[model samples]
Target: MLIRKALIEDLNNIMNIIANAINDMESKGIYQWDNTYPNEKIFSNDIFKNNLYLYVDKNIIHGIIVLNEHQEDEYESLKWKYISGNHLIVHRLCVDPKYQGKGVAKDLMKFAEKYAKENNYESIRLDAFSQNERACKLYENFGYNKVGIVTFRKGDFYCFEKRLIKYGS
Candidate 1:
């Protein structure tokens, strides 16, 4: 699979991937997303700002990730282990439900880490739905520190941050 910055034409494909993810989560009793969140407009905005990225293989988008520097107000109150104004905040990380167990999520995360370090960013920050055990486990196993919890429209989410270092350190 190849990971690269998303193009305008990739919007619809990305939305389909997200929809599949939402359905997969709800089917598993994880209410992490609903109709209102991660809508087309939000994704359009992300695409406009060139913050969106996609994992594509042979012309199909298998995963999506958004990286921005803005953190929510709720994050300001959390005690993060690493404090940095220079960081890449990850949002709306989703893999096509059909391709999930094939290490697509892992590839996306590794891409995020490399993106941060290559761009001279200090770290990667993100939040996961408290009920998304698979996502929480992925983040934890990947060495992201869960520093606090924050509430969003769906429900509570655990905030995480991973400080960047030289590759292979």
Candidate 2:
């Protein structure tokens, strides 16, 4: 498997994987994402703005992720705070449902941690929908500690952060 920066040409394929993943989630009673999350305009903007990354295996995109360099102002003003300094905020971490249960999310997270460490970021942060118990557990088991909560369009999400040391120490 290969993890690399996403290119404009990879947009449609990535979006399809996203759509299918959402549908699978919905079927499982997980309300994380749906059609509205990846409207045409949003995917177009993400491609044009260069905010996405993809995981490829044998030339197929099996996972997708969006990263933000800073926390939004609303999160910034919240009562809870991060460990310190700049953080790479992760969003829309979706693995193709076809490739589910194969550690894809863990691979993406390791990639994010390396990305942050190399860029001098102090930590990696993300929010899991409160109702998505599986995601919440995954975050905790992956070394992220819950620091607070924030409400998003779907619902309130538990915020988590994993501090990164220079060499994974």
Candidate 3:
């Protein structure tokens, strides 16, 4: 599997993965996503900003994520551990339903951490749906400290932060 910068041509495939994720989440009673939140416009903006990434295997996209400094507006109210300096925020992390338990999301996250370390980012911040137990556990297992909770379009989300200075320092 290869993870690289997303291109405009990959938008449809990316959206398909996201759609699968939405369906999976809905079937599991996780209301974290819907038709409106992560639309094509948002993905397009990420592509335009050069922050979106894709996880591919044999030229087939299986996962998508965004690594950048952009943070949710509600994140400002939280008291993060490493507040100063450049920090990479993980957003739009989703894997195709077919690749869900195959560690696709984990691979994307590892890539994001490596990207942050390479770019001298001091920390990594992200939010997982409070109701998405699997995601919350994944972040915790990855050593992210849950600092607070914030509400997004759907509902409550747990904000997590992990310092990268040990790797980047």
Candidate 4:
């Protein structure tokens, strides 16, 4: 599989992946996403900003991840460990339901980490739905530290941060 920046032509495939993910999540009792959030407009903006990426195999998109500096206003109140440097925030990470449990999300995360480090980012931040055990575990297992909680329309989410650069050496 190859991870690359998303192009305008990949929007439909990206949306299909997201729609499948949303349906699967809802079926499994995870209401973290819905029709209102993660709409096409938001993804269009992500693509336009050059922050969207796709995990593809043989030209078929399997997963997507959005990395940028934008964070919710609620993050301002959270006590983050890496407070004084450029940070990459992860958003809208999703995989097609057919590709779930196949390390697609993990691969996307690996890509995000590499991209952040290569781009001189000091840390990476994200918020996982409190009820999404799979996502929470993925972040925790990947060594992300739980910093705080942020409440959105769906519910409270656990804010996590992973520092990529140490102070010395």
Candidate 5:
């Protein structure tokens, strides 16, 4: 498997993955990502700016992460600052439904961490819908601690953070 920067051509695949994710989450009572937000504009801008990260296996995009150099504009007033300088914010992270439970998401996250480290970032921060218990559990299991909660256009989501520094240092 290889992780690389996303390009304009990958937008459709990423859209399908995220669309399916939203539908699946709704089916499971998790109201995250509807017809709004994360639309073409967001994806287009990310691809244009080369801010999207992708994980590929056998030349297929399995997972995609829309990352930014700093906190998203919507999160500016929420006190969601990252203590670490040059922190990369994980805006949207979704794996193809077919690739779920295959550690693809975890691997993508690790790639993000590595990318941040190489660029001098000290940590990464992200948030997920409060109703998405599976994602919450996944983040927790991956060592992300709940920093707080914030409400977005869809609903409230738990904020999480993972420091890159050594434990208890």
Candidate 6:
């Protein structure tokens, strides 16, 4: 398995993965995403900015994650723990439903942490839908602390942060 930057050619596969994820979430009563968000346009922008990444194995795209510094405006109200330096914000983390339970999301998250450390980021921050138990548990299991909550169109999301490096250490 390898993680690499997403290209325009990968958009179709990425969209398919996202669609499957959306269907799976909705089927499970988790309305975290829909057609309105994470559309092709947003993903295209991520690709254009070199922020999107893909997890591929044997030429098959299994998952995707966006790592960047673009935090939502709602995050401003949250009292984040690590406020001293640059932060890597995780977004749009989705694995093809077919690849679910196969460690694809875990691998993607591992990649994000490594990327942040290599880039000298002070922390990693993300928001998981409060109702999405799988996502919230994943973040908590990975050592991320729930800093606060932010509400979006669907509902409230728990903001989490994992400090990667101490500023003075």
Off by over 4 Å in 3: 166-169
Cα distance off (Å), candidate 1, residue 52: 0.6
Where model 2 places Cα greater than 4 Å from the true spot, the runs are 79-83
- Kindly list the per-residue Cα lDDT of model 5 for residues 1-169, writing each as its tens digit: 9988888888788888889888887788777887787787888898888888898999999988877766655555555445646667887888888899999988987877777676766777889889888888988988888888778777788888777763344
Highest TM-score, which number? 6
Q: Itemize residue pairs with steric clashes in candidate 6.
A: none
Q: Candidate 3, residue 79: CA error in Å?
A: 1.0
Candidate 2 vs candidate 6, TM-score winner: 6
- The candidate scoring highest on lDDT is 6
List, residue by residue over 1-169, the lDDT tens digit for candidate 2. 9887788788778878878977888888988887777666776776676778888999989898888775755576454455568888998888899998899988988888888888888878888889888788888998998888888788888888888787655
**Cα lDDT of model 1 by residue, 1-169, tens digit:** 6888888888888888888888988899998887789899999999999999998898888888899898999999898877754989999889999888999889999988988888888788999999999999999999999999999988899999999995656
Candidate 1 residue-wise lDDT at 161: 90
Ranking by lDDT: 6, 4, 3, 1, 2, 5
The residue pairs in collision within model 5 are none
Quote the positional error of residue 103 for candidate 2 in Å. Answer: 1.2
RMSD (Cα, Å) for all candidates, in order, is 1.5, 1.9, 1.2, 1.5, 2.6, 1.6
Per-residue lDDT over 34-132 for candidate 3, one digit per residue giving the tens place of the 0 to 100 score: 889899999999999999999999999988899989887898899998977799999989988897899888888889888998888889999999999
TM-score of 6: 0.97
Instruction: Provide the lowest-lDDT 10-residue window in model 3.
Output: 160-169
Flag regions of model 6 displaced more than 4 Å: 166-169
Q: Model 2: which residue pairs collide? A: none
User: What lDDT does candidate 4 reach at residue 31?
Assistant: 95
* Residue 7 miss distance in model 5 (angstroms): 1.3
